[model samples]
Target chain A: MGVVMAVPRHVACVMDGNGRWAALRSLPRTAGHEAAEAAVMDVIEAARSSGVTWLSLYAFSTENWRRPAVEVDVLMRLVRRAIRKHAPVLHARGVRCRFLGMSDPRIPAPLVRDVADLMTLTRDNRRMTLTVAFDHGGRRDIVEAARSLIRSALPADQVTEASFAEHLPYSDTPDVDLVIRTSGEQRISNFMLWQVAYAEWIFPQVLWPDFRATHFRECLDAYRRRRRRFGDVGRTATTTGEGPR
Target chain B: MSRTTPQESADVFGPDSILRRLVGQARWALPVVRATLLEAAHPQIGAALMEHSTFLTHPWRRLRNTATSARRILDPDPRVRDREVVRLNRLHARMSGTDAQGRPYDATDRDARAWVVATLFESTVTMCRLGGEVLDADAMRRLYDEHRTFLALIDGGSDRLPATLPEFWPYYDHVVEHRLENNEAVGVILYRLLADVPAPPALRARPELWVMGRSVAGPLATAIIVASLPESFSRRVALPDLPGARTLMRSTYLAAALATRYLPESLTRVETFMGLAGAGADPWASVRRQAGKAAALVRLLTPAAEDDGETVRSADRFFAEVLDQTGDGYLRWPDLAAMAREVATRLDLGEHDEERLFQAYAAWWRELQTALDGDGDGRVTRHEYAAAAASLPGSGLIKVADVLFDVTDADDDGAIDADEYHNLFRTAFQRDLADGGGTSYSRGAFVRQFVSFMSGQQHSSAYASLLSQA
Candidate 1:
């Protein structure tokens, strides 16, 4: 509606190079994750400052499980930490916390609780939704939605594109208006498939750990520089909507 | 502690994430863990509890006392009777909100759970010891449902389900666990019926209400539920193995009613997030019980709800009978797709000019094809999917919720709760399926759901005329 609404209905970020970021600094990958957590604060605040409402950050990925056992352990630990670590700030900032892949209760019950608690605390906060996609696969979300609809007692022909949103992981997290993939990755890597369809893509070369408010602002500047068009009749080539990468 | 201190706030975070560590440990060591948390905060939990009447209430007091008691059992040598006391106390503590580790309860803390599974022998003996409490229509119903474990059977073999079933969804036969096989391709027609009913019911009639956690179902809906109750709260519902479930429909019915009320307690109960654990689970239990207690109070203090044996039109009953298993091939998924395409094409609405037709049936078909990455027999056909999309009330803007369902079905389990639902949508919509090519409309099951959703709205409106007197 206004710049207030221009705050990306959805924003996805590819938090890349955690290991490399750690390795370059001669620290444990966990340290990098820890550093990344700090960076998360920076990006999130900057996004909120820019009037972006929903920020979907790509933290741990489904493929990340392929990493060394030690690394995976550290990541899971980091995940648990991140969940508890951000509570007060989340409550203060009026941001809700949700993880895309970790739904089952068996998936580190404590971490799950923390994530859930944070979300519960900020459930009423309309400021913005900061979604952390952990071990989430974009393709999986699409298929899952299909399957869920199929199982519902609700009728089939009744299903529609807009209707499906009610069943998604980040159902209320707005449409992706700008995508910023750190470490210069051009691919969305199966981040948000359905919601990001029309989001504008921006690739920043800076490694994730090095990324800061300045870089975040740069992305916003870039986002402001472009125009968004959701495949309609009038707008043709230049402008596109924003979404998180 | 006045206004704000960024550094102290930060103290609770990072790799130095004390809260996280505390939460993780709380599951295993509740008391010390909780005390640690309350200690970290100003003015400990015991003190906090003293300040709030919500804690002094029966349930909270029992919960608090048990937690304190359990901390005693940790010692090596406790008398046999006292040890027995420990077990009984655990049960009492749980109801009070204390964590399993005998720590103070923080309803908001995700990791803490006041688990106290009561043993059968003790509970049975306990029931015999304490006389039951019964009040009026609502109270009796509430207590009956919450307490009655054994139910006597009458005509039907299974008394588990309500005698009178819902009409439109006859496919709900407890069939094949999660898989319901309707010989008739009811999915297609049902979807259509759901999408565009001649006159849909008001929103309140539906179990899962809209955004604000409320169902605007009219008074008629209540009357309908009331009508279904066997008119006798003591009807027997025998279970095959475990003690027959309490015939007490009061608790269950009230849960549904409370859900319809749109209260915060109901919000905690219905909202998908955090629903599985802690206070979030059965958050509405208290609300329903309170309503029951209020009903009891009213019987003592004022006029209770009066039910006239006078003849009332059995509209819901008639609809239920007519709605069930008509099985005629009235509408199909393909028909819906065609309709969606027609509508989208007519509207000429799209986010970008090129994608204007993207919301159409053809676009839906392509999108579905792409999502499948493989072809299937009844997969959402481009036309079928688009029809669903174009059918939803929204014009051009993509419903973020719809996009969520288009993703997130890892194993095809069929249904996703709110949390899982949100995760899937976030992944797909945010990721844009990798290259950011706009998501297609054929993944439009959500649109169909929306169509039927309007029916609840209609039903609620119908009920409004009758209930306004209350």
Candidate 2:
């Protein structure tokens, strides 16, 4: 069948299998992480070209702190270097940069400053918003949102789904429409729980380091073919409008 | 992040999340059937079916169609999933008729629509509860909100819908108390369905099968249905509280849940119904088989060739003759085997075809056994056979026409007006004949086309030509 695409406004990705990719090539995991930068660039270009307004990448999770201290250090340094190296290019391409997740002290002070600076620098860009979720947990985000709501002393009846969403870290970003996870992992792993309530999920076999613009396009095409019901019935062209009750 | 966030995390449940797993794991088939019966209890819908639906004549077909629609509603793609709701809305838009009391009925009636949504909600909750999941007030609220969101998609908006879960209860209770009726249509349909509990081959061939089966199974089926219903609704429907039966059902559900928990995800998940919607193995293969058996039974029972002195002319006559030979309603395997041999000999089967003919006979008996046997117990009782026999005479062609006309006649004026006719054509063929410019046929011409189509003559040339172009 021909691809009749309906591009989602926002696409979130769980980039997995970097360690596996490095292991497969008999290289250090750091090399795999470094290689993933190219894939990220390619995906950003693809998202911009495909009319995607928001691209949220699961770059780091709260659980990542459990890794070896050396690996964690290497990852933090890699994140800082990637931002510094690619900020100019991303800004040039009119991509707005934002950091998501908790403002924990565990995420080095200098890295946090760099993230703030980069976000400030690219705040006015219009082409796309790239949200790198470092030290993020979906559960954590919800907790923070609830805390904010409590702090504001909102009335009990005022806590609607729309209202509750506003307290999240990235309130400006819309809910995720598509969540793509690489290396064939099917589970959500607690990523963007609230945002991906109705999102279409696609799990491809390619590792994070190998995922390219072509793979991204393929995922989008696959998404286009799906019929998103939103828990409602399907309608066809011949359907007649029902009279009001 | 200081081990974890200091603030408490709220659990998020979505379509692809754990909530789907909960729904998937639950044994929903029985609850769904119970829900459908409850929905049909509503006077308007019951009356609508009595007048315009072929459900009684083609029960399995109607059920399969409903299952297909339900599967589409759960489809992953929002675009494809919403089509069934749209179709229902469009169909309902044109649906208007009179009830048994001569009161006008419209599908868009707010109360009628609300009752339908209530049935869906109650059934899902009932199923989840039966599957050993107890919802707290907050969880129930969330579920209610989710269903409201779903209803909004169907009803176009939530203006007429209740604002909160608590507010919905009284409205639902009121509907159940007053609006639902123990109408003839619902009673007859439910009785027939209950009576036709398919049994195994051993029980099916028994003499006076239906008499014995109905005696034992009929009351049991009624008790189960009663037990499944809410207490107030049960009383309204004049069904006694079957406490013992309810206990049995609970135990059965508990056992089912335990077994399902151990089973693979592929087995528990209600993916697609008959491979109609999603990519997966057809989970309803048995239902499809039953439908095929019902169709064959209808064909065989219909009067075909003229009766000869020796040769069987119709399935009804053949079965009667076999029953006479046995001197009881029960027909043992040996009796059926003998009958098969005799029929084969009468047909003068060639030596090479004899084995194949016997195999066919065996296969037919097996299919009949499967279709009649509601319980997997190898023995089929008389009631099971009677139930299968009851469905033999298919809904006649005229009844089908009546149903079609009832649906197509938007104004219920006994005639299909030009606009209604075009609407019917578009709905049936999924094409707009007037797209080229104006309707090529007049009202009379369109009526002629319908007549020709109903009579099994050549269909409308315009329709045929249009279909060919696509």
Best by TM-score: 2
What is the lDDT of every predicted structure here?
0.42, 0.61
DockQ of each: 0.01, 0.00
TM-score of each: 0.37, 0.38
Q: What is the per-residue lDDT of model 2 for residues B131-206, given as tens digits with 9 covering 90 to 100? A: 6967888877777665555555566655455778777888778777887888866686567656643332222222
Ten residues in sequence with the least summed lDDT for candidate 1 chain B: B147-156
* C-alpha lDDT of residue B251 in model 2: 69
Fnat, one value per model: 0.00, 0.00
Over 4 Å off, model 2:
A1-245, B1-14, B17-26, B197-219, B271-470
TM-score of chain B of each: 0.18, 0.54
TM-score, model 2 to reference: 0.38
**How high is the DockQ of candidate 2?**
0.00
